[model samples]
Target: MNERITPASDPSTWGRALDEAVNILSRGGLVVVPTDTVYGIAADAFTPPAVQALLDAKGRGRQMPPPVLIASVQTLDGLATGVPAGARALAEAFWPGGLTLIVRAHPSLAWDLGETHGTVALRVPDHETALALLARTGPLAVSSANTTGSPAAVTAQDAYDQLGDSVALYLDAGEAPGQVSSSIVDATGETLRLVRAGAISLERLNEVTPVEGPTA
Candidate 1:
């Protein structure tokens, strides 16, 4: 069953909550966590059992792979390859924040990360708790903490309401900032392409990188 931890804003409670979350993760358990955008159910990226548990909890199909969250842009180097110059620029400009990137995965992955036909989706979340957890666990495979085809949860209660006892831990950092999920960009090329649109505007992306239209 899922248990709701106190708000992470409280320094003392926050430390306990973070420690418990990390312990659960290290033991291959799933945690419903807060991110800059929405609540997501996360598992250790390198653990096959953890990945499977996350997928099973979501009742997700293997055809659609989950996205991985990295602690920083530097973490991307080890898990993925061919991170194009434009992608790096975007990461520098908007990382440690919203923005999921689809790039080629490193050849030597321990678990089945996803089926992007060789590509992987990665993001660096912009939350202290998220970053702290990532730093401790390395990287995490995370997706919105809701049943497939359901509206994303923006509050801990929403997550608890929908996910119920499916998750191991619930990190309630109060309500989310309410920003939509990051706009996805495929920058594995000289130009950036908008795969999905959200809080990060296309114009803003253009200001920093060449937000090119998709190529056939």
Candidate 2:
């Protein structure tokens, strides 16, 4: 049975919820957590089996890797290499929000996110609960909490209906503000390319840095 945690409850309860979520993640177990955009299924990014299990839960394949949710913008450097000036500028402008930067992975990092092509997508979600959990678990490989090709879950219950017992814990912060997914920008190359457009509009991205490619 999955543990359902409402973090908005009393103080002691919130602490217990956080502890449960952290313990599950540390053991390479998957959890459904709230994000600014939507509910996300998260697992320890450093654990290959955990990451693979997340994919299996979603009925997804290695071709589509999950994005890494971070606690702070400062953690970006340790996970990615050759960060571009524009990427840094964008992070400063839109971080702690919906913006995923695809950058080259650290050469010596011993984690496989599957078909990442030597790169990793990193983001700092705007939700407090997610940040708090991320602060404890380091980085989590997170994706929309739904089966592959299904609509993203906007609430923990919606996620549970689909994911069921696959996730070890569910951090329910009520319904999420269902918005577009994070805007993805490939910063690994010299020219910043827009891979997917979502909450962050193209105009907004251009304001931070000159982004190339067709909008999603």
lDDT of 2 at 202: 81
Q: Per-residue CA lDDT of candidate 1, range 97-194, in tens?
A: 88889898888887785566777889999987788778888889999888887888888778778777778788888777844877889866556799
The per-prediction tally of clashing pairs is 0, 0
In the range 1-216, model 2's lDDT, one tens digit per residue, is 335645543445578888988999999999999999999999999999999999999999999999999999999889988999999999999999999999999989989999989999999999888887888889999999999988889888889989988998888888887456888999988799999888898899999889996655
> What TM-score, to 2 decimals, does candidate 1 have?
0.92
Each prediction's Cα lDDT score?
Answer: 0.82, 0.89
Best candidate (score: TM-score)? 2
Clashing pairs in 1: none
lDDT of 1: 0.82
